[model samples]
Target chain A: MSALLTDDSIVDLHPLHIGTEEDGAVEVGRADTGMFVALPPEGVALLRLLADHLPMAEVRRRFGDSYGEPPDLDDFVAGLHECGFIRAVDGVPWPEGDDERGATEADPAASPAGGTTMRGIALLGGLGPERLRWLLSRPLLLVFAGVWLAVPALMLADPSLAPRPSDALLYHRVLPNALLVAVIAWTLVMLHEFAHALAARARGCTGRFSVGRRLVFLVGQTELSDVRTIARRQRYAPYLAGMTWDLIVVLGCLCCELAAVGGQLPRTVTYTVALTFIYQFSVFMRTDIYYVIVNALRLGDLMGDTRRLLANAVRGLRHSEPAYDLSGVPEREMRIIRWYCVYYLLGSSTVIAGSLLLSVPALVRMLRIAADGMASGPAAAGFWDGAGFVALVAFQFGTLGYVGFRDHRRTRAGTAATAV
Target chain B: MKIQIRKLERIETTVACACGS
Candidate 1:
């Protein structure tokens, strides 16, 4: 056991914001790690006292006065200490020892990209002006509402405007057009991510812009560090902001296509924009829509919980050791999990079907075309195109494999740590 | 008693509590 609490021991509690007092519970979030702990009222009171930098003896005395008994001060403190919620101020050894195995240290820059590449860019480090805040509020929100309503109405009126899988493949045939569309698409995605950052900034939260890969897809992420501290209404703004920009681009493309004299450029733009808009609806990946759903539903660890549930079910069928035991899950969340399981199946199937029908075919065609060009002659254009296409495919798949490998290794390390 | 501490590390939602909390 660690040393007992003394009257003079100084402690430094991690910076956190307490959630609204509701139902005899409070949500505490550490700002640095973005970790939330739902505590009973008594726990909140104890933590508040500790946060004031009071000695352990004072905290326990006050806690006893409030709760009618000298609560197990040592046990509670040990729990908090284990969770990295509190630290000794005078460099005293923690009761749990220096084994930082279980505590989650909040390091925002941690990426699967192996630390060599740039992870993210901090766009807004601090709160901005009143005007910027207002933009993220009523007027812009109303504008987004209009866009949301207008998009479906427009698509309904002009069914032809909806991009088809075949249109995406058109880029694969025309190399120059494909290159142009790729650059434009990349720029638009970055802008979409930037909009998220702007929304976060408007809410007086720091927004970080980052480019990373999730599986095979390249992603731009906006990290709103203080999002949990804000109201749910404010939280939805950043989540929806990226999709709002995507919709705008789609609308702009449609308008351009309607006004064009006669060329592939306008149609290409429309195709790319529409495809990008559709991509945002990919719920399997942590897309903008995924966040919107998560925030709206108030689900905590939905994916992880659902995954564990599935694993446990499979293990039970096979009569093997269960990977997860979920008896402790709240009934309400379990109900939600059931619904999420259905959606997960549907979403995953759609992605698989789409990839098989579209992406796989496109890749095979590109490979064949590259091979033919190389075998034909020393044709400079053909050689360059073939090399470029090969390099692009190699890089994409290589990064995906590398990231997957890293994640698997990290997961093993974490499991080992837990075992110890 | 061995309490399983669930770590909620995702950006969307998280909750920290002991096994029986």
Candidate 2:
């Protein structure tokens, strides 16, 4: 009970971070506790009254003056306590051990990637959110968009600037070409992730870069949760910024390719960027573009929700239940989910199939070439190079297998715990 | 007006780079 009948029945709340939501809601939370909740307008009013340190009786009277009916303050205050918003009740400190909230701060970038939990290391000049004031300007966004557009515009004018599959082989020695692509592509990848962190930071989000593996491929990710405080309009830049960087890079590489005297280095980079651009369309893989689509549509937990819907459908097949229950999903979002689920299904199958067909054969062909090189003695220049290539392939697939197995086991354990 | 109290949300946003085709 709130002990509201007394004259001095006052309650104190922890400092709250209150902000507006895109959908006419309110976001309230403690940044330290990492606990946030979305509330309607009247709830915000009630919170404001409590935050002003009003006594419960006065709070109810003031709230009733604005709204026709008084809020169920006991229930509301209880909810606040559950949310870790209560600091004290009637001069008594909030209990420490009893709350299930686990209110300790979470390391925003603490990732369990590669089977290790570690804080994401900041790289390549991460400026604080306040110092990056220009990121909020509209003109800077145009400059970014204009540069992205210029890449294709120039390629359209001169088709020679377009990337080709032939550009994959960059140097006389296979090892040097592989090394160069790895170096440049990874450097580009880091810059791409850094762009995301910068945009997020500029919008008052703190995040760090970490290396993680997704399915069969290795990836870099930025862990930022505070972007939720920003509206949907502001999120697009952070999500699409990486692709914009890739395009800007493609444009730069294309110009450099033209300037170079018959050298393939720039073209090689253009091809790598082009391949990455194509990869952004592989949305089922939860790429940056997936987040863009998610934010654009104002959908919550699209990936996890759709995955749950599918899992439920599989479990309910004998009962003839539908694949998804549309009761909880909003009508507008349901339309997108219908289309997106289909796209996800088709896209996932296509990617798995395409990778198996194309990448497997490509890997095999490369291995065959390396084997021919290895057939010769150490006197042959390609012998050690072939060995290096073989080792790289082994490491790539080796990491993939290990991560995949770990994910599978974790999923099974989660399922078992859910059953229990 | 009675305002509804929703559950706490963990607004985790991960910006990942995976252009793997």
Candidate 3:
């Protein structure tokens, strides 16, 4: 017998942002809730039919007409229902296992699928609401643009303003000085994220401020909910807001450094500012500049596409089956992806090499100094300094290790769930 | 009136049926 179906069992489609994947599959994302699912062409066709709110028999009939055979409508609908993509709009009860799934209205951040978790309380909901809206207005945006253009020109004219590796506030006496720098740097990062939130708010979009781990580092994130709906031009404000704040800080520090050339201000101040500026340009880490590039080119998933393209190239060389199929990528994006792959590889190599050459050596030296000081005895002043240094290093690396471990477990769980 | 108009425009542009039709 056919499954019990009711005329009142209308399916309400969740607001989804759809995009085409590289392999010609359809990717549908509920941006606000962060529910993402990929589907084959036939699955997408079924989704379209469901979105029409047709009765079960009508959907089945359409599916049969389109595919020239009977389709597993019940299984497909059940999967969608399970994923929280559709809901009953007519107050009708769902089939057996559906009600047992419980309510799906909980915060997506708390139970994010694919092993991602956005932890921490939101500090600010809407910041400087009216003032920010005014600042992001078209006329004021021109002023912002002028300032953005002038800062680079001003920096270029001043040879002292050029960012250099020596600009990093790394000194021999590294305990108190390093701690102070770390505090200030973190404050600046917070301000950068706040700028993004403000810009998003200005464009009538809500930005949620939270601290989350991105791979190894604890990052300040502004989750902009309405970005997909907003105009591309308005979207630019939030994407570039963090970098704009960084530039302002850099310029301000440069001015101060210029004024107090030798004595009043520590060179470390200017150096720290320059270091932040340089860090933003590390597009390999999906920094602000990376988003600017992606938005400017109007390409979806440039990083993912580039990675897949490179992986496929390597596979081709070894005559092994490629892990990613790139045939569905549009010609325009494919060309851009090819160039991006080259740049990304070269830039990543440079960053990796720089870390090995400079950061590793500095870390090793500090570790040795701290170890030696500890060995000298607790009575020595060096012992306290060494202990502080060791604590700081342990705190930083321990946090990194813990975050990486959590991410690994989440990824394994997600993969196992998908396999099942 | 302006806010309502803007909201309508946003809904028209952002919200869409799964079928392009």
Per-residue lDDT tens digits for candidate 1, residues A237-302, read: 877777777677767767776676435555555566666555566665556676677768766556
Residue range A1-420, candidate 2, lDDT tens digits: 455435457788888888875465676776544456668788999999988888888998999999978888887887787776888878888752222232112211111222211225543235667788597578988888888789889989999888888887787786656655666777878888877777777777655565555435566666444566676688777777777777777777877877874488778778887777766667765677777777677675465456656656665876765644435454676677667778878887776688799878977887888898889978997888788787877766676676556444543332111100
Tell how far residue A257 is off in model 2, in angstroms.
2.0
How are the candidates ranked when ordered by lDDT, highest leading? 2, 1, 3
**What is the DockQ score of candidate 2, to 2 decimals?**
0.33
Off by over 4 Å in 2: A1-16, A21-24, A28-37, A40-119, A122-126, A213-215, A320-328, A371-379, A401-420, B1-21
lDDT of 3: 0.56
lDDT of 3 by residue, A78-131 (tens): 666555566454445443322111212221211221112332233344365676
lDDT of each: 0.59, 0.65, 0.56
Model 3 quality (TM-score): 0.71
Q: Using lDDT as the measure, name the better of candidate 1 and candidate 3.
A: 1
**How do the residues B1-21 of candidate 2 rate in per-residue lDDT, one tens digit apiece?**
445654332332232232222
Off by more than 4 A, model 3: A1-9, A16-29, A35-49, A59-84, A88-123, A126-131, A161-172, A208-219, A258-267, A314-318, A376-380, A415-420, B1-21
Task: Estimate the TM-score for candidate 2.
Answer: 0.74
* Chain A vs native chain A, TM-score per candidate: 0.81, 0.75, 0.74
Pairs clashing in candidate 2? none
